[model samples]
Target: MSAGTAAAGPHALEELLGDPFDPTNPAGYRAAVDADDAGSVADTATRALDRWGAGAEFVPASLGGRFTAVDELARRFRPAFRRDAGLGLGYGLTSLMAALPVWAAGTGAQRDRLAALLAAGRPVPVAFHELGHGNDLSANALSARPTADGWMLDGTKQVINNAERADAVLVLARTRADDGPERAHTLLLVEDLDDLPARGFARLPRYRTTGLAGCRLAGLRFTGCPVPRSATVGTVGHGVPTALAAFQVSRCVTAAASTSLLEAALDAVLRFAGGRELYGRTVADLPHAQSLLAGAYADLHLAQATATTAARALHLHPAGGARIAAAAKYLVPLLVEDALNDLAVVLGARGYLREGEYAIVGKHLRDAAGVSIGHAGGTSCALTVLGQLPGLRPAADPPDPDLFSGRPLPELDLSRLRLTGPRADPLLAVLTDPTGTGSAAGGAAPRTRELLGGLAAAARTIGIRAAALPAARRGVEADHRALALADEYARLVAAASCLGRYAAGRVDGSPGGLPPGWLDAVLRRVVRRRGRHGEPGSATSDSALLAHAAARTTAGLSLDLDPDRVVRHRPHPPRRPHPSRVLTPTAGGTP
Candidate 1:
């Protein structure tokens, strides 16, 4: 388990891939493409990863592995995400999703079984969502009928990652068909798919996808499959609660991992822009290019802050953590998609090409699209937020400093995770606390005060709307102001995350923390997104922060804290003038 420490896994994984872009290396973009066609990582990469015990990060320390903290889990998985989205989802996150339920609510034997399998670098597929009822696990059609000695399982699950090759599957089935919504589903730990009797069950064929081509997206169909009663994961008729509870973890991972992928995309574009010449100057010298890079950089930081804080809140604020998780899942991926779109304009044609120079940009963009829309799409998340609006209130105290102090968290109490939490939002507290240390009275930055003011206004607006909406109209009004408040809630939460991180730094009395300018840049973007334009004393600009991010990327370091040093590609030299050379948008600035 020592090797599974926060820094160890990512460091070892990074060493395994080396510099993916190094022309002299075999494990570069070509390798990724080959893996895509084969629908798995290259044998050499897999063998190397297996040897590194990368899977141990999925198991808890008490279970003989090091899955202690959510933040560390996200950090450790960065190398996989940075390398290739298909391989990352196929090889890592999917397995984590499969194991989370057992860890959260499984028996000792179940946890041990999952821990041993993960420690051995084996795959585990979590089959939850059905094609007919996406995100609505309560409507799952799969059935586990009671038998004399066990349950007979029958039905199918679709769009599952690694389903075809999973060593075992965590299945959700309808256990009490005649029961109400809450008692309808049960979670089962089913294995021995390869050994099942003929005609009992079969693995569905893999489904091709537009992105993450290497991922084995497939389905499963069961026909009178018999399994011992021991297969039941938790209390009978509690499957819906268990599944919803587990989502708080998986959704955060999806958002965090996707953000990590976006960082790689941003790096690729930065590498290209730094090297290319536009007219008489480098593309990085163009005002539009600079602004785009700044916006993307700021967006990435905002997302990182949101993800980090929410992951911490899993332990720090267990009461309402599910909503926080939903907000992160809903908001961060969209921000990443938006960031990618802005970068696409900067990359021009390089963004469109699927192969060749800067191909990873296009590949990552496509793969990221699925993540944005796959699990609990934006609309579903909006509904989640909308439903929770009636319970929201300004926090009485400031957000706990531990959430953003960058310190280690205590062991996560998965059992403490709730399906629904009080509407109280601590992030919003940062905006409402008049006497907080960073308030304008304490001489905080003017931009910070203005941003806080905007948040206060937005909160008032949402509170009023949430109060006025009758219970019967909640669903019908969701499309109108309910959805709008949900959007604002997301932005407010993100803004609060940014400010909370900064405030935590102040609480620790740490000198030379994130500069005020960075906070201002983040808040400017937050307010702009909230539809509160032309706020007085808007952030000046993010030019300096953008330059700093570019330098960090050039040095092969991530924008987040304690960045793992990665393989940095040397910038391509400016192209020489030639009669055969074309300067169209499709022809990116340099090779």
Candidate 2:
């Protein structure tokens, strides 16, 4: 088997399996995903826990959790989950979501209590989504009323994973009837699964889902389910923000899981290409197969990197981490989808069969389908959040350039750039006229300029890569396009990093001013040049690149540096074009 194969050592599959759950038993988990028997899959997952380890993966060590960083957990879980989608989704993702209510909004006491409960092997399921309500917590029809002693929860939550097996459920309920935002909603920790009020909670039969079938995502109904006043996770009426904060973590984890699936798909395609012969040669020798494999690998890397960055951001800035998390959430699932489809093409007829190991591919494809549509809401929701960022405006007209333009290119004041201290020194020296200025004329120092120049040159190299495209049109498939977009995003982030270095006084910058509108000119050029072909793009195409760039620039600006210019664009709704709308059809009815 290849080194990247799912059966590799425990750590190799950790990214797919998550939880350091096990190092040697991944194949067993793989069996769970492949088993024709549903009960067997659930049984396998329940027993697999011994190897996966205990406690919520994202919870802090102080809270009796094993995971210290979200990235570490992501890497470990990616492989295992890829091998067995159902096991991963059921135990890995559902656990992450179940733990979020307490981590994001629970009181200190609540956090300790919930953490302990999880450590003791009691799975906590989150019941937030309901039928017909979409994923909006504010639109929740579930009601919680206060009694003399406590509160009674009356409502139903649909598509709850592990609901039938949960020891406790972090239930979201509307505490107030009004539509206005207030202390109207609350999250209650409901324990005692058996004692759940008579007919208050019912577990509907598992829906025949396309993927992640091991999870018992049954509909749950709560009719006058009593909850204690102390059972509230956070303040009453703050469930919306609390739930959203929890979603940030969920988005990050889900992105990681999707990345795992992509990696698995890529690995499968690589092996299949090598062994499967066609036209008197192995498929691996074919140019198309090679290109597909390469493109898929690149996308896998992009997904992993993006998820890692978002996970780190979650640790640093929990409050405003939504946009970054959403970027990964929106991007990774699409990447996995493209990767799987490409793999199917490479596998040809064998890919279509469900008789062998390849059956997992279809299972994974189904499981991944839900990643974009699950609890955190769809890509549309993610775009709405991106629209709120500074300089993103919706498109106003047909063939709208405003969808891609309006944001100024980031500018940095070289003179204000700092090499080490918080103040600008090297930049000031360079900008100062050597013949007539204070520092420059005095020949105070030249090292800062040299360093700044070197860094700028490196940044330009990245920018060049971002701007370049292969001349061969055949190579630019959907996966390739996705990879290229991610690459550009990385370059933008690198530029932001360079800017931040200068701002931090890592390099001196008090550089002279540029010609008026120079920054605007550059921005316009970049936006116009980006994806000029109008190829169908991922849901996060524009926003992901912009968000990454914005983040880098924001960090750089913190160092007191300035970009030549900053372009802010209005947010535009995602574009969709139909055939009839674009061109006339032939009389034969063929377009």
Candidate 3:
């Protein structure tokens, strides 16, 4: 089997798109910024991606497209997300979201039609929520009443993407209003927009946004619009469950790729901090600035590892992996937003500029902030975990070692993914299982072991509280306090992933071991991010972590688990070997 994402080698988009830094390149950062100013996506980027068949990323490999697994899909799209978050969402993610449910539970003809539309370079937007319901999709007001021939759709699905121009739209509508919340809805791939007259269906005006200005966030209104019975996706009344299964993939893939938004922001700050002078020295010379930059860098790595491990879980254990997917989606975006805030500080006023080289820092800051709430948001995702907590199977074996391995993952089998399954979370075992090689007995150093023990204790405490929660309190009805438990549980999941990755590097500390002190710094970060009055990391260690950040940038590489795997639009040739001697994820980051 091939090694991880990088096994694809330098992505074609990275090479074909040209250096984003080149001021003259029409598809470069300047173009993206300029397009954002005009409140429209850069047409140059749209056409380039279409010409490159970027839509293929959404199609399944079996159907003549590149999609195979969630992680691989994330890695492929990183090159795009790192460029313009709007482009990534408008041209990439939205289509993937609309297509996934079809892949998971559509008639063979529906899947084939989706494959063809995407191949023709058209984005099919999924309309799951209305403006009134927001993340509470269960309350969606759109109605798809059953007709003699098929169904008649009515009401507005606001806040949808590409609604104004797409030839087709995938909509979720109430087919049985009298049924329970989960059974009232159905998914329909509505096509033949031209078949309906103005009164039957209309495209609403584009909604303005504070971030992702260039994205076309529009709406579709259907007033007694008719669609044949073939429009039904999956089974009638099973729409909610079908959507849930597909969400496991979208949550993992989109959450993982969204980190590149912060990567773009951090890249801008590092570039500015190392060069811009302040008080007779470059900003990089300031200790305080170094700490902020380094801490942000460390946060990025943890976010990457956590989201990625969740992606791996989708493949290795889809039955009980929804919690991990939810956890990663909840935490990574928050981590990226906080990191962007720190980076904006280091960049100072220049970070706010909209017309210069550092424009991306300001732009990405806004885009990354939007990421925190996208795809039903961190709060909704946390609820997803809270509902599953009481069912967590503690005796489940630790995550398969292959979860960390850089090798190729199995193809995504939507058939195995469900709305709810055995909540056997192996990542939890990494913290609670003291005898397992992933934790205290995994040859971890004294400080590392101590941190693991504390987190393990916290994990146990949450398990107890979860068991005590009334069934009513475990779901969407959960209060703020119960939601906080989900947040804490997610933090512990991230911690376990870090420790698991470090231990998997090697118990004997051989040639392929992770850098000597990396685990200490990250675990301390995890601990510090916990409950109020959190633990503080040492200044010296934070400085060392900053040095790693600096070294990687100096060599034009990523700062995450996969240090050697460079996917930036700027094709900076190797300057020199990294000074830290960090091996790419022997079981993580690849190429």
Candidate 4:
């Protein structure tokens, strides 16, 4: 199936929200958010949730919710974000975070308890981020002390979303006093917000945020809040791994949210550009505006594809989900932020006007700023990626060949993958450096042939080594340095593919044609061989391929491809809404 095709199985939660772009019903998406009425956003979201019978929207069918498939949930939840940025984020993301601890580490009883609360229409918010410490699950300071009947929790959880209204808060706290690391902590359920002060827990006023306003992110201080022993969500001291896993899932959804936000902003900008005249022509007719539009469009598509790919990987391999999620979280935000800025450029001065209906553009741009910072910052993403890579390294034994065959390049699709156009030039420069000569290109004037041969050999060797390692360790980082190396290797491979395609095409009289099925076949064979060779061979073989590809492409042969030339430029035509008036019928138009 194509990448964007709906996954085979149940319909997604996003599919349930219906079409948000209906023009005739301009307020079809509840503008309560635009009115700056927090209560209205929350109330409208709750009504929509209940009306769609989306109680099981986030819960897996195994837990008794409507969604039996993650894809379905992702699809269903997408519309909410598309409709209203703040409400979509509050309903979809905040709720998911609130419910994740239960899904990851909750005991059967805990799961049942939390699931029941959600069913009762009480939204829960997750309290995982603290002031200074970000994504370091091991640095949490909230403490939970054991008592005869339960435990006393004391600490301050800052920047908690939905703190004022959530039925419960999943608080991560250190149970052991020792400074071994926050991993020695437990997840505790805090249930009475109204009585927080009496229990020594107080809620600070919500912080003024640029986006996701309806969230009510506030600080909660637990002076000495008490909880039953059963409040522990999972095995004590295992909270870090559980929380990390939950973070992986959350990152995927967050990326999806970013994508939705970009899409909405792009749609609005496109509509405005079409009719707004500048210099005796529509802004859309300007060359620079077209360039900006194209770049934003390409970036938005790339972000969607990358995020969706990461989501699919998470669904299939929930074990190594963290690393994949980290990659998506890091890359997608950067993509969306750039696109948002480009949209502003496309609009010029008109985009800056806040008193009008399009004020949300600025709001979204501000909201998008948080995605790459805070708990989900780039540093945190890098650390998580580093940490998770080690866990994906293959064990020191040979893995079954069949295993590698079935899981060839599990994390990336070789067929359609292209070297990032920007990186291609520098890599080519390195490969073709005159001083290095054959050392980099690995041969003489026929650089393409040499590069292809080197790529094949490296693939063969790595394939053998990978085959030897245990299947479970293949995707682990092993170390920070290893991740950097792997990233370089992936980049080099992409560059070689680009250059190789250009080279082969030149020889075949099809200057831009890529090698027919060469990339896919070679990658498949390499992975198969690595699976057979064991752990050591995997690294050795990968390094060999990198070295060879570098040498083959860097020789003095110029491929004449300009990385600066944006290839996928196109202006978005305005979307006109059907003359439908009913909300229920309009909902069905959403995909």
TM-score versus the correct structure, for each prediction? 0.92, 0.64, 0.90, 0.65
Q: Which 10 successive residues of model 4 have the least lDDT summed?
A: 557-566
Q: What is candidate 2's lDDT per residue for 278-384, written digit by digit as tens? A: 44555665666665554454345445545655565455433334555665676556656766787677776666665564556666666788766767644443443
Q: Per-residue error at 532 for model 2, in Å?
A: 15
Q: Give the alpha carbon lDDT tens digit for every residue of 188-290 in model 1.
A: 9987778877788888888998888888889998999997888899998998898778778877778888887778878878778877766656687777787
Q: Which parts of model 1 have CA positions greater than 4 angstroms off?
A: 1-7, 435-447, 473-477, 506-516, 530-540, 554-556, 572-591
Select the stronger candidate by TM-score from 1 and 4.
1
lDDT of 1 at 438: 49
- The clash number for model 1 is 0
Ranking by TM-score: 1, 3, 4, 2
331-418 in candidate 3: lDDT tens per residue? 8888888778888878777777898988977888888766566667988899888987874645456778878775787678888876
lDDT of 4 at 100: 74
Tens digit of lDDT per residue, candidate 4, span 114-156?
Answer: 7777666567888877887766667878888999998888889
Residue 151 of model 1, lDDT score? 93
Which stretch of 10 consecutive residues in model 3 shows the poorest summed lDDT?
Answer: 1-10
Cα error, candidate 1, residue 348 (Å): 0.8
